[model samples]
Target: MRELLYEILTSAGRRMNFEQTARLGNALGGLLWQALPGRRKLAVEAMVRHLGISKPEAGRLAKESFRHNARSFVEIMVTQRMDPRFLAEGVTFADPERVRFLAETKRPVIFATGHLGAWELQTGSLGAFEGKRKIVVVRRPKDQALHEVMMRLRTRPMVDVVPHRQAVMPVLRILRKGGMAAFLVDHNCTRDEAVFLPFLGQTAAVNLGPALLAVRARALVVPGFLVRAEDGRYVQHFDEPLDTASLEGERDEKVQATAEFYTRAVETYVRRYPEQWFWMHKRWKTRPPEEDGQPRA
Candidate 1:
C-alpha cells in the first residue's frame, strides 16, 4: 500500500484530490492493516469498531475527502491570476497608489508572504502598482511540466520568475540595480536561524530572510498578503515596512520580535477567513522551546 501510494503520487499526469489524498492516508492505514493482517482501512475500522458508527455513516465521511483537496487547490489557483477581480470575483485593493512608494525607491525591497491563498497572484497583481521595475518570482521549482504551467500562468508584462536557488545571484544583481526580490520565508528548515512564533493560535516556524535582507540591503521589508474578505473578495494587504532601523545591531532581538510580529499579522489575516487558510499543513509541528535557548522538540 505504501508503495502504491508512492507510485500514485509520483505518477505524472495524475491529479489527486482530497479523497485521493485521504486514500493515501488510508494507505498509511493499509500498512497498519498489513501488519495486523485482519483489518479494513483505518478510518473505516475505527468508525465501525471503536466509534460504533453505522456502515452508511462511515461510508459517507470516507467519500468527503476530495472536498478538502479541491478547496486547497482552488485557493492556490487564486494567486496565479493577474487580476483579483477575475479570481476572487469581488476583491479589490484599497490603495494601489501606495505602491509608488515601493516602486520609486532606489533600494531593493523584500516582500514576505506565506503559504496562504494563491500568493503567486501577488506578483501578477503587482502589475497594477508597477512603474518601470519588474517583479521577479522566486520559487523552488516543483517539476518541469508544473514549472512550465506555472510559468505560463504567472508570467506577465511586469512579472517573471527566477528559481529560488538561482535567484540569489540574479536577485542580488537586481537589488544592486534597485529591483525588487520577493520571497516567502514562513517555513525555514533550521533551528536558531529561524524563530518559532505563534500563528493560527499555535507555534509556527518562521525564517529570518526578510529581516536579514532588509538589514543587509537596506531594502524595505514589507509584509504582505491576500487576506480573504467576508464578501468573498480577496483584499491585497501591504503592511508598512517594519522599523528595522530601530532594530539595528540588536538584530537578534529584532529578528525574534519581527518574526513574532509577522506571525501574529498573518494569524490575523487567517482568522478573517479560517476556511481559506491551509489547515492541512502541520503548521504547529514545531514545538515551542522549553526556555528561550532550549532546543525545540
Candidate 2:
C-alpha cells in the first residue's frame, strides 16, 4: 500500500514537463516557505547575519534559496523515473581526473560535502562515474514511508544508502574493500556527538562521524561541492583531500581538528554558493557553555 502510494505521488510529479514542474515547484514552494513563520524567520535572520547584508537583501536571498531548493527537491522526485544516463549527461565534473582517481583507488576514501545544490544528483553523478564500484552514503533515517520514498529517489545501481546509526559495519566493510563512503556533514548535532567549529564565521556544532571514521579507517578525506552554474547546468567540484597527520595525538583532538578542517571546507563552498546551502535548518542549535556558570539551553 505504501509503495503504491509512493508510486502514485511520483507518477503525478512526473506528469508535468521538466521546466514546468520546476517553475511550479519553485513558485509554490517559495510561497509555502515564506508562509511558515518559524522557518521564514530563521532563514531571514541567518541570511542577514551570515551574509552581512541588509534585511531586504537577506529576504530576497531567502526567497530565491527557497525557490531553488524546492526546484531541486521536485526535480529529484521527478527525475528519479528517468534513466541514469540521461541525468548524468546534464552534470559536469570540475575535476574528472580527481573524481576518477579517487573512485578507482585501492585506498579507502571519505567523500564529504554539505547540503549544497542538487545534492541528490551528487549520488547519481558519483554512481555514473564509478560504474559498478559501490558508493556508500550515510543518511539520517526519516519516517518509515518517507524514508522508503527518499531511498528510492536517492539510490542508484552503484550507490547505496545506509542509515547513520547502523552504518559502521557496512562502511567498514566497504573501506576494507578499498571502496568509498559519502556523508553530508552540515547538520546540527547533539553536544555530546558533535564538535564546535567555525562555520560561516560563527561557531556551530558539526558532526565528527566522518572525521572519526576517516581517522579510524585511514581513509583519504575528500571534500566536494555541487553547485548550479550560471548557464543552468550543474558542476561537481572536488577539492584536495584533507591531511589528518596534524590530528594524530589524542582521540578527542583528532576528532575536533577533523571536524574543524571539514567544516572550513564546507564554509568555502557555502561562501561561493550562498543560496544553495539549506538555511531553513537550525545549523547552530547547539551552543557553548557560559563563562558565568549557567548552562546554555
Candidate 3:
C-alpha cells in the first residue's frame, strides 16, 4: 500500500514541471500543516525556545518550513525524471576558490551538513565539482518499501549511500583512501551514541559519528550547506575546515570537542535560515542523565 501510494505521487509529480510540482507541494504542505497540529505546535515551540522568537513569528516560520520541506521532497521526485547533468549544472558553489582547493587536495574530507535546503541535491551535485564518488551516510528507513523508494531517488552515478548502522568501517575505509564522505549531523541521536552539546540556544544530544570519524581518519571536517535561491537554483557553501590539530585531550574528549565545533557550524546556518531547517524533529528529546534525575553510570 505504501509503495502504491508513492508510485501514484511520483507518477503525478513526474508529469509536472519544477514550478508546477513546487506549487503542488506547497498545497500539500498547507494541508499537512493543518492535519498535523501537534507537529506544527512542536515546531513553533522549538523556535520560540531556541530562536527566542514570539509564538506568532515562530508559527509563521514553522508554516514556511513545512512548505519548503515539502517543495524539496517533490523536487526530489521530479529529479528522478530530469537529466542528471542538467540538475548538476543548476547548482553553483558560493566559494569557488575553496571548492577548487578541495577538489585539488588529496586529503580525506568529511562534509557535515543538516537537513537544510535542497540537501539531497547538494550531495548529488558534489560529483560535478569534486570529480569523485561521494560516500553518503544515512539512516535507512525501516520499511522495506520506503527504503527501496528512497534508494531509487537518492542513487546517482557518483554517489553511494551507506546505512548508519554499518557505516563505520565503510566510511573509515573510504576516508583512509583520501575519499570524501558526507553525514547529516542534525538529527537527534540515541543516548549511547550521542554527546550533549549546545545547539542553537539549548543543550541537545549530538551525533558523535562525524567528529569521531574525522578524528580517527584524520580527515578534514568541512561544514557545508546548500541553500535555495528565489530563482529555484542552489548555492552550495563550504566553510573552513575545523582545526582538528588544536584539539588536545583523551580520545573521548577530542571527540567531544570535535562534535562541539561542527555543531556550532551547523547552528550558524540554521539560525540564519530558520525556515529551511527540519524543525519537526525532536532535537532535544534525549536529556542528560542528571537532567532526568538519574545518576550517571
Q: How does each model score on lDDT?
A: 0.54, 0.75, 0.82
Candidate 2 on 233-290: residue-level lDDT in tens? 7788888887564456887777777777789888888877877778888998787654
Task: Go through the candidates in order and give the C-alpha RMSD of each one to the true structure.
Answer: 9.0, 2.8, 2.8
> What C-alpha lDDT, on a 0 to 100 scale, does residue 83 get in candidate 1?
58
> lDDT tens string, model 3, 116-197?
8767666565664456657888888889887777777777666678889989998988888778899999899988889889
Off by over 4 Å in 3: 11-17, 78-89, 243-246, 294-297
Ranking by TM-score: 3, 2, 1
TM-score of each: 0.62, 0.88, 0.91
* Better by lDDT, candidate 3 or 1: 3
Q: Could you tell me the TM-score of candidate 1?
A: 0.62
Worst 10 residues of 3 by lDDT: 78-87
Model 2 residue 259 lDDT score? 78
lDDT of 1 at 61: 41
Clashing pairs in 2: none
